[model samples]
Target: MSLRDAWDRFTASQAELEADDEQLEARRRGTQPVGRCHARSRATVSGVIRAVTFAPAAAGPALVAELYDGSGSLDLVWLGRLEIPGIEPGRRLVAEGMITSADFGRTHATMFNPEYRLLAPDSAEATP
Candidate 1:
């Protein structure tokens, strides 16, 4: 890539990190950290959406999403859900649910059908 392209990418990443930090702090103001989550205990986190995936299961479709804050990342599984409006990469969200280990040894904190709130896009987070 050209110098201009590389510069743009670098700046973008830094901006993203700052926004992620702010969102995480705001969301976790009175909640547990993702890295410190305890099994079977209720937990909450705020972060930027890293991914959204779709897969099929016996019951039906499943939506698996990952979010990353400054401290850590977590996986959110919505069984029988295909798509949730506003759940996409870079979007900030606050999620609450019981912390549980992955039955299949998968890594990271996880929650099933946790209550979530999509954060409104503010000027700072919306900027490139």
Candidate 2:
């Protein structure tokens, strides 16, 4: 890498670097950034699964995953499911569903039982 590129990388914060990488991946996959998605609108977003949590609710078991796509994170919730095959941290995928902000205009946005496709592990074949 060039000296200027190295300098920029060294000066950038960890979050900035991660955001840049996520944005690049989103662009390459032609998926919408999670931060740009509006409430109550249907959107297709691509990102890496950061965390997965299994919480038992009154209705049923819920699997919630935090998907970060550089710009922001979206919570993917699957009701009545304890686990899903290939749903884990560090996996990349594209999900589509109606966006909802349960916190009333707060930073939290969620998609319930979104239609998703798991991507390959490498950069190659990452596009759908």
Candidate 3:
């Protein structure tokens, strides 16, 4: 890569990291820490989607997504939804709903059918 190309990549990565950090800070400022969430309690949390999976559920299909802030992570579950247009790994989003204590295998904490908002995209997240 040329010097300019290398510089561009470096700057892009830094921007992504900063944006991720900003999201984490914003989540901490207004919401309860995900790790401290209690069973059946209504919680508001925000973070970046680190992973996503569509699993077979008794009803049909379920979307299992992992949101990770700097402090912690939580699992967001949506039953009967095959896919959401904007939900994917690397997306920053906020979710609000009840935290279920119901056992979900390896899930840390789960929110079913929570209200969510997708944040603005950072180009760094889209870069290969």
Considering every candidate listed, which one attains the maximal lDDT? 2
Worst lDDT 10-window in candidate 2:
100-109
- lDDT digits (tens) for residues 1-128 of candidate 2: 89999999899999899999999999888889998999899999999999999978878889999999999999999989999999999999999999997763235899989999898988626445
Q: What is the lDDT of residue 53 in candidate 1?
A: 90
Residue-level lDDT of model 1, residues 1-128, one tens digit each, is 89996776577777576755655575545656677777788887777788999968767888988977666678888988889888898887788998887663447668889898777776323223
TM-score of each: 0.72, 0.87, 0.72
Clashes of 3: 0
Q: By descending TM-score, how would the candidates be arranged?
A: 2, 1, 3
Error of 3 at 53 (Å): 0.2
Poorest stretch of ten by lDDT in candidate 3: 119-128
Cα deviation of 30 in candidate 3 (Å)? 1.4
lDDT tens per residue, model 3, 28-90: 558666777898899888777989999996668998898877656788988898888888998
TM-score of 3: 0.72
Worst 10-residue lDDT window, candidate 1: 119-128
